[model samples]
Target: MKLKLNAISKSFGPVKANSNINLTVDNGEILGLLGENGAGKTTLMNILTGLYKPDSGTILIDNQLKEFQNPREANKSGVGMVHQHFMLVPVFSVTENIILGTEPTTRFNKIDLKTATDKVVKISSEYKLDVDPNALIEKLPVGIQQRVEIIKILLRNAEILIFDEPTAVLTPQEVTEFFEIIKSLKKTGKAIIFITHKLHEVLEICDRINVLRRGKIVGEAFPTKTNNKKLAELMVGRTVKLRTSRRKMEKGKELLKVNNLSILSDKKEPILTNIDLVLHQNEILGIAGVQGNGQTEFIEALTGLRKASTGKIVYFGKECINITPRKIHALGIRHIPEDRQKQGLIGDFSLIENIILNTYYEKDFSNNLKLNWLNAKKEARRIINQYDVRTNSEDISANKLSGGNQQKLLIGREMSRSINLLIASQPTRGVDVGSIEYIHSQIIKARNKGIGVILNSTELEEIIALSDRIIVFYEGKIIAEFPSNSDPKIIGLAMAGVK
Candidate 1:
């Protein structure tokens, strides 16, 4: 099988997402699509997957021109995409999620669960996916859930597979396993398009790499002939610093202290159990853990977004447990939430509005009755310029910006204020290498300025790089703690609940 996108161009209003983009992937090969955020990689993939119609282009499969009006048509033509975010229903079983849209029916016109389970089991075995057909998605690990996604497209008989940031959430061990899976898929004569912002990943696994910049294909390179620095420059059209430089700073006064923090769900089940930690000024305390291991609940409890059953959260010697979010904000504690679109920014609101989202009631931006639009817009423009949020105008809706830009905007909003403590959860998640560098620098800057930072991220490399001290969370408890220079292998084991 072969997939070809020729002269593909797409635009939304004034923003040209893709411009005269040309690309191809052949069977038994993995083509890496590399780009910074908002560089039109997603637009090009959306066009290929029939999510968006190209203003001008021809999609050719096996030398025959084909136009896909919908995703179903694209899937029928052996084209399918596994989105960055999983589309599985949390409550659904693995087989149910795989056969959700295309269910087999009995002669009586009823869903055939037995047939679907058998097919899912067969695919899982054949691809070495090792997924349980009866397992619920919520109960399964992220790596296994990814396999379920792959199995979903395989059941459609897809010859062309597009994986968008597939390894973004995977552990280092899982990433190695995922690469083996990709190699196996290639061996089976599947055309794979691997889209990611990780430079080292493309160099490790891709047969050929194509770099996108400003909605155009700037360059292409083979893995052997290229390196991270070259590829990052190609993606961002600049010399990108792949690592952050941190200066040694002594830990200062205590900014936050948590003692016996325990949170319970509405059903009275413990979400966070007996958590105790402290954050000192001029320090970045990195919280390392696998996803769903009480990190989210702990951050929420600290930010006043979630109520704890029992705890004493002392901020600057004041007990602030169960305080309102606004009161927390008053204490100069800023938070960059995990989910950017859902928690960080209001999609429908303008960038200017999102800039002052939490601070709109402040004396500078408001007079307690009406918003001071002039000052708010000025601050919005300042953040846009300072944070490098790529948008044409501050009047545009927050949704108009890409994922990375949205993140920068959120970071800018949180950091622009007078904050002593910054609770940045997944600060650079889904951001490109260029933006990651900037965000890391900003975080280090905050730490250097005597601001306490609680950095919670699933990415271990990030934790190792920026953190002065590290703590591991496992099953709702701090299982272990380590210094900045601790070996990552030991930390990884600690994250897996090994002390």
Candidate 2:
């Protein structure tokens, strides 16, 4: 199968998301799509998948023009997308979920789930996916759940597959396995488009690379001929710094300490058990783990977003156990939450409003009677200028900004305040390389200024690059600790719950 998108142009009001973009993918080819946030990669993909219509464009499959009215139509034409976040239902079995919309019916018009399960098993075996047809999604590992998604598309006879950040949540071992799966798919004569923010993965897996900058196809390069620096430069349209530069410094006095911290879920089951750790001024305490191994719960407990069943949280010599989030903020503790859109900002709120979302009650922005709009707008503008949060006006809604810009705004708001400690979780998860560089520099800058930082991320490389010390979280416990320069293999094993 061969797919082609020609003269694709899309506009949302004044923003030109894609302008005359042209691309192609053939059978047995894996094409990597590289772009910065807001560079129209998503828009272009949406057009191809029938989620959106381009203002001007043509889609050709096997040299024949095709127009799809919806995602189902696109799927029928052999185009399928495996989203960054899996679209499977947690309570449903793999076969049930796969055959949801297109279930075969028996003579009595009842759903022929038995037939679907058999087909799923066959597809799984053919692709080496190794998924269980009867297994519930919630019981499966993330990597296995991903296989179910692949099996779903293959069962529909999809010839072209789009994987969006497929490895973002996978552990190191799972990533290796995923790469092998991609290679197998390529060998089976499937045209693949792999979109990811990780430059190294693209260079390793892609046959050819096309970079998008400001809604335009800037350049194309083969993985064998180009490097990360060149690709990053092309995506951002500038000379980009791929790594942060930091000077060595001694770790200062203890700024925050956790003692036997334990958190319980709503059902009274333990989520974090007897967690003890320390953070010192002028240091970045990196937390490494897979997505759900108590990292998010631990961060929530620290930020006072979740209650701890037992333990002490000491901040600057004050025992702040069970403190309110406001009190935590008052103690000069800042948090950049994991899910930016949900916890960091209010989508309908203006940029100026979001800048003061947590600080609106402060004296500078409020006087107990009315909000100081002038002061709030001034602070918002300052953050926009300082953080390079690309937006036209402070009056625009927070959701109007791109993912990277939204993150920068959140960081600027938190760091701008008088803070002693910063708790940043997944700080650069979905950001582009240029923004990652900037955010990393900011974290190191905070550390250099004698501020303690608890850096929690799923990206091991980020943790290794910026941390002074590292701790591995596994099934609600800190299994191991290591110096910043410790071997990643050992840490990775610890993350997978190895002793």
Candidate 3:
């Protein structure tokens, strides 16, 4: 299939999401779509997938102009998209989910469960997806869930597959396997669109790269001919400092101490074991690990969201165990949660409301039982301007902003308060390089101002760039520790459980 998007233009009132954009992808090739958050990547893909109509454009598939009124129509036209968030039912079996909308019917007019199962199993084996046909979705790991999504697209006989931020949730090992699957699919003459903010992955897997900035196609380059720096420059429309510059930290008194920490599963199996750490004021301690290595559990326990069966959690040299998250916040511990949509902000709430979600009860925000909307709006606008959130009004719902802007808002909300320690997990996940640089600078600024920071991220480069000391976690235990100057290759090996 040779797919071409010609002079696409889309407008939502005054905001032009995509403007005069042209792109192409051929069979047996991977086309990388590189852009920052809110750069119109989502708009272009939405138009292609039939979720939105392009104000002016023509979609040519094999030289045939096509118009798809809905996703089903697009699917019938051999277009399938895998979203950043997997669209799967937790209770459904793999076969059931894959054959959900397109079920085979028996002669008796009943759904043919056996035939669907067999087909799903065949596809899984062919692609080396290794998914069990009968496994329930909630029980499967993230990587397997992703495979199920791909299998869903393949079952539709899609010649052009659009993967939107497909790797944002994958582990390194799974990432390696995913690249192999893409290669295999390419060999089978499939056209793939890889859309994401990660620059290195573009170089690693893509044949050609297209960069978008502010709703326009700014540049395009071959992976071999262009590097990450050049791609970032084109995507951001400026020189982006890939690494944040930071001064030497002046470590202060111990702000938090954890000893013999352990997170037990429902069956009482140890998720994290014998963890011990000390976080000092004016210091940044980074926890680096692949996904699902007890990092999430550890952070939850520290923030009082999860309880450890055996551990001593102390803050300010006092026991903080059995405390609520609000109490921990009252004690000057702020958390920037990993999953922003689920944990950080209320989607239905305005940006002003979310900004004051945690601080609405303060004396300045309330007088007796009367809450001050005036003060809340004032503070929200201040944070918005201070954090460079890209939004015109604070009255708009949080769901309307881009992911990077949402992150900036959350970080600003967390850091603007009186905080003694900041626990930030995947702080820059899904954000662009420009926002990342700003966020990293804000973190360093907080650390320099005598606030203890615990930075947990899956990106090794981020850990090495920001942390004063780095700890590698594998299977819930610290396997290795290194200074800020440690070689990334060594840390990578340690993260993979190398001795």
Best-performing candidate as measured by lDDT: 1
| Tens-digit lDDT track of model 1 for 144-217 | 99999999999999999999889877767788999999999999999999988888999999999999988999
Write the residue-wise lDDT of candidate 3 on 332-410 in tens digits: 8999999898899998999999998988888879887899999999999999999888777899999878767788899
- Candidate 1 backbone collisions, by pair: none
Q: What is the lDDT of residue 64 in candidate 2?
A: 90
Rank the models by lDDT, top first: 1, 3, 2
Model 2 over residues 1-499: C-alpha lDDT tens digits?
9999999999877889899999999999999999987787777887898999889989999999989899999999999888765788989999999998999999999999989989998988887889889999988988999988888888888899998878766767789989999899999899999988899999999999999988999999999999998899889888987767778889999999999999988889889999999899999999999878899889998999988999999998889998899999998999999878779999899999999999999999999999999999999999999987867789989877766678888888988879899999988877889889888998999999999999999888899999999999999999999987778899888888888
Which segments of model 2 are wrong by more than 4 Å?
85-118, 132-142, 264-270, 347-353, 367-378, 393-401, 496-499
**For model 1, the run of ten residues with the poorest summed lDDT:** 165-174
> Which segments of model 3 are wrong by more than 4 Å?
107-110
Alpha-carbon local distance difference test for all models: 0.92, 0.90, 0.90
lDDT for 372 in candidate 3 is 97
Prediction 2 TM-score vs. true? 0.90
Worst 10 residues of 3 by lDDT: 399-408
